[model samples]
Target: MANNQTLIPVAEPVIGDKELAYVTECLKTGWISSLGKYVTTFENRFADYCNTQYGVATFNGTVALHLLAAALNLGPGDEIIMPSLTFVATANAIQYTGATPVFVDSEYGSWNIDPAVVEAAITPRTKAIIAVHLYGHPADMDPLREIAQAHNLLLLEDAAEAHGACYKGQRVGGLSDAAIFSFYGNKIMTTGEGGIIITNDQALSERAFFLENQGRYSDNPYWHPEVAFNYRMTNIQAAVGVAQLERIADLITIRQRNAAYYNQRLAEIDGLTLPPNQDWAENVYWMYSVLLDDTLPLNRDELRQKLRAANIDTRPFFYPVHQLPMYDTKQSLPVAEDLSRRGINLPSGATLTIAQVDYVCDELIKILT
Candidate 1:
């Protein structure tokens, strides 16, 4: 165990002076509600940053996806295909629409939804495919796009973990028909608790905006065309978002540098598989994850315990959605199941220092060795 008592966190929001100033201004101006210039500014700036035509901010990422489902008119018999390895919110969003979520396995190469498995899973009931950019790496989008195009299905991206990640020289959010981003505190850019839907389709953008604000159109006051949700992001959250967006490039750089340092130090260690660095993709390393080789003496949980004892915090990867009690099934998914058991997220916070990374890595190596 380290002599130093300073606890290294697994993930944290990097709130700087700009965030404080913007939030303070929002409070001083009494624009802390959903109706404020900060919300509009944040939507526009974030949309522009992602190379999208429009952005509709929402209360959170899950609600942003739920709004997308509502806009798409998904319900009852409609089915949405997604990887079983991602956060439950992805599947839950589809479920909220009264739609069934079809589980697909992830690719071992990138640890994202396997496009090859997607085609076989699609049926007449399939409405769309939610390709998640898992662990900051973009999924193999070209083939997924081709599949969507061939089947006349909408291709959506879950870019919750990939703020600045890119695939084949294009941004992940712009590559799909529409994409959702989570601005949760631990994400690369934070809005305290918020999300945004980015799309090139004006109709979808307008519908999302309308549905997010209690189904009442701005032009038509007190007229409810249909049941909707109050999923609007508050001005305070947007204020923080604008500031975080301003520093996103720098934040991404810091994460990349930290990941590189970890790679250098941990690559030589046996019984560990580092996160992938694809030639066609630039991963943002949202959480620097590794899969413990089966040969390792310690299991993933055991290793985490050892790391914690050394004052180095870590997190386990998400369990397969299909395996969860809420969506229990007999269907077998070998890759996702294997990854869930073996993968562990090291401390990859953007604010983490090089020395801190070294300490975490040294302790990790010591435990593994």
Candidate 2:
């Protein structure tokens, strides 16, 4: 490893001039708060991009989930099924409503929730199934959708990392009863920090909007019918979002291209398993993830330390939510644990260049050899 090498970030947002212009307009007009044209524009455009009929913008992804939970009347007695191998917010959202989040294992093929396991995990109390498009790969939704319909359970997507990803021919965010997306600094798109819930159900959309705005009805602004949180996305955030949405295709394309290059270089490496893109899915490759095979002499953490020493940044896969201290249930989901232990997210930001990818791979090969 050389001492003069530049560090590459694991993920980064792509911002442009349109974002600044939109925000500046918001400022000149004194519409800095959530009330502004950009808000609705971003909501509608993003919803339309995802092939959804409506979108309810939120301060962040977690609140979007909470709002959805609240809108659905999910409470203490109910349960929602989701893959254990996901960001904590997925489970936290359901937990916020006093509803239980039942954890399931992931399948090897796509590194997403196993539809078979999901079906097995369902119980009478289960009200919904959330299929997160983990690391940009869509979960096998058709089977999950079938299971949901047969049992009369709602299906949802946590597509925080999977902007523009698609299943079969249809885009995400509209595949199920509803879906949520994050526009944090690290997501494929950036709004600085924001989120949205997209769905075709007009009732759910209206209810979510009502809940996010403190449950206030327009006719009675001062009279709040029910207690709800103020979870509105700022005009500034939406300004950035609308700008990013305009370049959404480029954002997705560059990442996919980078992933292809990574796959080309890393595929022959015996101990590395490249990210998956199923035939039925169009992966956005939100993060070019690879798993460390047991055949590798060094473990995942050991390799990460080596890459860090070489001035190339990386991130380990998230700890399955169920294994976290608060959510610990002594359940043994072998697949998720194994993947978490071995998976690594390389510098997958949109701005990364080919030379940077070459440098990272060179260092990795040296370390592995």
**Residues 158-203 of candidate 2: C-alpha lDDT, one tens digit per residue:** 9998999989988988899999999999999989889999999999
Q: List the residue pairs that clash in candidate 1.
A: none
Worst ten in a row by lDDT for model 2: 1-10
Count steric clashes of candidate 1. Answer: 0
Alpha-carbon local distance difference test for all models = 0.92, 0.91
TM-score per model over all chains: 0.98, 0.98
Candidate 2: where are CA atoms >4 Å away? Answer: 1-4
Q: Model 1: runs farther than 4 Å from truth?
A: 1-3
Candidate of highest lDDT: 1
Estimate candidate 2's alpha-carbon lDDT, on a 0 to 1 scale.
0.91
